[model samples]
Target: MPKKVTITDIANLVGVSKATISYYLNGNTHKMSLETREKIRQTIEATGYQPNKIARSLVTKDTKTIGVVIADITNPFISSVIKGITDTCTSKGYTVTFTNSDNQEEIEQENIARLKQQNVSGIIIDTVDANSPNISQLAFDKTVMVDRQAKKLRLDTVVSNNRESTVNFLREMKKAGYQEIYFVSFPIEGISTREMRYQGFMEEVTEDSSHLLILEEPGVEKRIYDLIQKAKDKIAFFTMNGPTLLAFMKIVNKTSFRYPEDFGLGSYEDLAWMDVLNPNVSCIRQDSYQIGVLAARHLLAKLKKEKSSSSPKLLVVPSESVIRNSF
Candidate 1:
């Protein structure tokens, strides 16, 4: 096997000390002359010398690695977010280590702990339950939460404009002559995204709980059917997210009712599959990828101590309304 090249070999080839090579590798080149820098760069290129990240991290206490905790990796929306995160991190010369929580609180907590144990420079998490006590106690200095918010708002958070976009979408439904609109979700359960969207929905509709359809509840399909039958005017249903929208569609498909004729339908997420559906579904389109990028940027800012705000910052990425024939 060919002998592996090290920084010392590159330094010897360039007639410089090991510290000079270290400085060049770490981008601390302000003190080095242009000619010296050029020679070191060329030598490294010729030898294909790769820095030992573990040794460098042990000395500098910076891994240049960010840890990510995803709530559910299977979701397409989340996959887009992950792409954005990785792309941004790579451009910044940082790498990422990620774990999937599968939407389990215990697993999310364990993922966070494991990342911390790895001594990652920082962490970005799409938490399963932001309001959990364990989450509340985490060190916010190097952690950024995406897609969810804690009740107390102790850490930097990035999320779509859930409330405002929802309200706007519901308004469009109202303008389309939807007399009675129902908000369908799995369960609020203190989830900030669900609660915020529900709040926006209730702003334009009646505050009565009867109009709230819980997909997990018993006899929800019958309840939805009865609502469609007894409605005094044209009615519609607004779902909270992609999965909730899928479950709602499944139930509605089983019945004889169809969209924009028997009932109107709108949803929160604008997934790709929704576009291919018959008479595509009109919905609120969140920039989930942007949310991920912003989350990573925020965490990097905190790591670099460039962020001045000691108080928690809430970054809201605006969402767009994709109007279609479904409503």
Candidate 2:
């Protein structure tokens, strides 16, 4: 195997001192000429020499690494957000360590503690439960929340306008002649996007005349089918997550309920298969990738000690409500 090259080797080949090479590597161009900087960079690149950021961090006390805890890595929305974080962090010469909380409060807490122990300079967390006390109590110099919020905690958070978006979506559906609309929501005990969406719907809806069912568990598919069977007057159905929508679809198929004719389905999370499925699900589409990018930048700013007059802020992204034939 070829021997690994070092910065010293690049310095020697470029006829520059080690200090000069270090300065160039650190992007310190104030004293060095452009010619000299280019020569050192070219030499380093040609030799395939990589800087020892870990060793440098030991002396500088800046690891240049950000730890990220995602609610569920398997979810496309969460994964897209992580991709944004990775792209931004890598470009900024920082590394990322990612952990999955699996939507469990205990697991989420353990992961946060572990990330802190790893000496990550900052954190970008997609909280499993917004109400998880661990999230509120955890202390970090630089932290940002993505796609979730904690009203009790004083921290930077980036999330979509859940209430406004949901309310508008439902209102538009109602205007488009969706009568007897039914909503199926996840149980709201944990730190969840489910809660915000529910709140949004409730605030916009004054009349409780329509059938609105809140699911306490995953087995609410039967209840949905029963409602659809009995409430033949109802025209639309909505679900908060992909799993719930998928389960409901299964029940609909088993019960031989035709789509559009018998019922309509709308989803909150824009899962990949939503478009390909029969009848094509309508949804409120959130920008998870952009949320990730914003969270990373915010946390990095915090880590760099960037001062601002504003207090802990909530960055709200907008959601696009796709009007498919589901309505």
Report every candidate's CA lDDT: 0.90, 0.78
Instruction: Give each model a TM-score.
Output: 0.94, 0.86
Model 1, 186-233: lDDT tens digits are 889789999999989888787899899999999999999999888899
lDDT of 2 by residue, 55-131 (tens): 87775677888989888888777878988899999988899999998878799889989988888888888888765
Show the lowest summed lDDT stretch of 10 residues, model 1.
131-140
Clashing residue pairs, candidate 2? 129-191, 130-191
Question: lDDT value for candidate 2?
Answer: 0.78
For candidate 1, what is the total of clashing residue pairs? 0
Model 2, backbone clash pairs (residues 3+ apart or across chains), number:
2
Give the TM-score (vs. native) of candidate 1: 0.94
Worst lDDT 10-window in candidate 2: 205-214
Off by over 4 Å in 2: 1-3, 12-16, 31-36, 136-140, 190-192, 207-210, 217-226, 230-234, 306-310
